[model samples]
Target: MEIKTIGVVGAGKMGNGIALSAAMAGYQVVLQNRTAANLVKAKNSMENQLQKLVQKNVVTAEESAATMARVQMTSTFEKFDAVDFVIEVVAESLDLKTAMFIQLDTMCKKEAILVSSTSTFSITALAAVTQRPPQVAGMHFFIPPTKLVELTRGYYTSDETVNQAKAVAKQMDRVCVEVKKDSPGFIANRIYTPLFLEAFKAYEEGLASKEDIDLAMKSSYLPIGPFELADIIGLDVLKSSLEYYQSELGPSWSPPLSLKQLIRAGRLGKKVGKGWYDY
Candidate 1:
C-alpha cells in the first residue's frame, strides 16, 4: 500500500521523532496522544527538535517550520480518518496494546495497517485481538526513529505490509531487518538482553566498577558498554524489558537488584541526572 498519511499513537520522544521524520518526509502525520497536556508537550518537543534541525542546517528554517506544520496533533481516535498506517508506541503492556488494537481495528480504514513499536511481545497474539490480523504487524523503530538502522518484523506480518513498511522506511532513509518472529525481544532486544544482563551480572559478581567496564568497552572500540548505556537509557525501561525477558526466557534475563532499587527510589538514568555514571 502506498502510504500518504501516517499516525503515531504516543507523543513521547520516540513517537515525536517518528512523527517529525514523517512530516519531514512530506507525509501528513496525525500525532495522537491521550490528553491535551500530552499533545502540548509533544508540540513543544517537536518544535525544539525542528529548531535544532534548523540550527544544524539539516533543514532550512522554512523547511523546519513547514515540516512541523505538516503534523496534525489531536487527542482522539475520531481524528484518525484517512490514516494509511498507525504505529502504536504507547505503553508497552501487552494487554493495553491488545486493547488499543481492538479499538483501532474498528476505527481505521479497512486497508490501514496497525503496527506496534514494541521491543518485546507477540505480534501474532496482538493481531489475534484485532479484527484484521493481516493488517496487524510490528513496525519496531529503534529508540530514535530518525536514526533507525533497521526494524524487525513480526511472525505474522504479511509480505505486502512488510514491503510497504520497508518502502516507507527507505523513503525516510532507514534499513529494514525482517525478523522471523515477534516474541518478546524480537531480534535486537533478544540479542541485546543477554549482553546487558551479563553486564549487570558482572557488576553483581564484583568484576569491576561500572566506569571501568564502560571504559574497557569504549576503549575496545565497541559503541557503548552495558551499564553506561543503561544509564543512557533509563533504568525503568531496562526494568520493563528485564521483566519481559525474564517472563519469556528464564532467570538469566534477571537484571541486577540494585537497578530495581534505584528505579524504586525514582532515580532513573540520564533523565534523572544519575545512574551507574552521573550524567
Candidate 2:
C-alpha cells in the first residue's frame, strides 16, 4: 500500500524525532500523545529543530515553514484514521507496546501499515497480539532517525510489508538495515547492550570510575561512552531493558545492582537532571 500520511504515537523523544523526520520528508504527519502538555512540548520541540535546520542551511526557510505546517499534534488516536501508516514510538515496556499494537490493529484501516519503534523487544511477540500480523513489523529507529534504522520482519510478516517499510524509511532519508532473522536485541543492540552492561559491571566492582571508563571508550572508537549514553537513555530504562535481556540471554545481561539502586533512588537520567552524572 502507498504510505502518504503517517501517524506517530507518543510525543516523547523518539516520537517527536520520527515526526520531524517524516515531516521533512514531505509526509503529512499526525503526532499523538495521551496528554495535552506533551503534545505542546512535541510541537515546540519540532519547531525548534526545524529552525535549527533552517539556520544550518539544511532546509530553506520556506521549506522549514512548510514542513512545520504539515505536522499536527493531538491527544486522540481517532484522529489518525486518515493516515496511511501508523508507527508506535512509546517506552520500552512490552505490555504497553502490545496494548498499543492491539489498539492500532483495531483502529487503523486494514490496509494501513502498522509498525513499532521498539529497540528491545522482538516484533514477533508484538505482531502476535494484533490481527494484522502480516502488516506488522519492527522499524527500529536510531536516536536520530535521519541516520540509520532497522526493519525486522516478524515470523508472519509479509515481504510486501517489509518493502513498504523500507520505502518509507528511504523517503525519510534513513538507511534501512533489514534484520533477516528476529534476534533478541536486533543487530545494533545485540552488540552494544552487552558492552554497556560490562561497563556498568566494571564501575560497580570499582575497577574504574565511571568517568575513567567513559574516557577510555571515548578515547577509542565510540562517540559517547556507556554511562553517558545510559544517562541519555535514562537509567531506569537501561535497567528495565537489561532485566528483559537477562531473562532471555542469561546472567551476562544481568542488570547491575548499583544501577538498580540508582533507579530506585529516583534518579532516572538526563530528562530528570541526573543519572550517572549530573545533567
The Cα local distance difference test for each model comes to 0.81, 0.89
| Per-prediction TM-score to the true structure, in the order listed | 0.92, 0.97
Cα TM-score of candidate 1: 0.92
Model 1 sits at a Cα RMSD from the real structure of: 2.0
List ranges where model 2 is wrong by over 4 Å. 144-146
Q: Compose the digit string of candidate 2's lDDT tens values, residues 80-145.
A: 778888899998898999999888888888898899988889799999998889898999987633
What clash count goes with each model? Answer: 0, 0
Question: Per-residue lDDT of 1-279 in model 1, one digit per residue for the tens?
Answer: 689999999988788878887888899999998888988988998899888878998889999888888899998988776899999988777778888888888889989988888877788888888777777778778762335534455556688887888777777766677776666787777887787777777877999887788788888966778777787667888898788788888987877788888888777888789877666
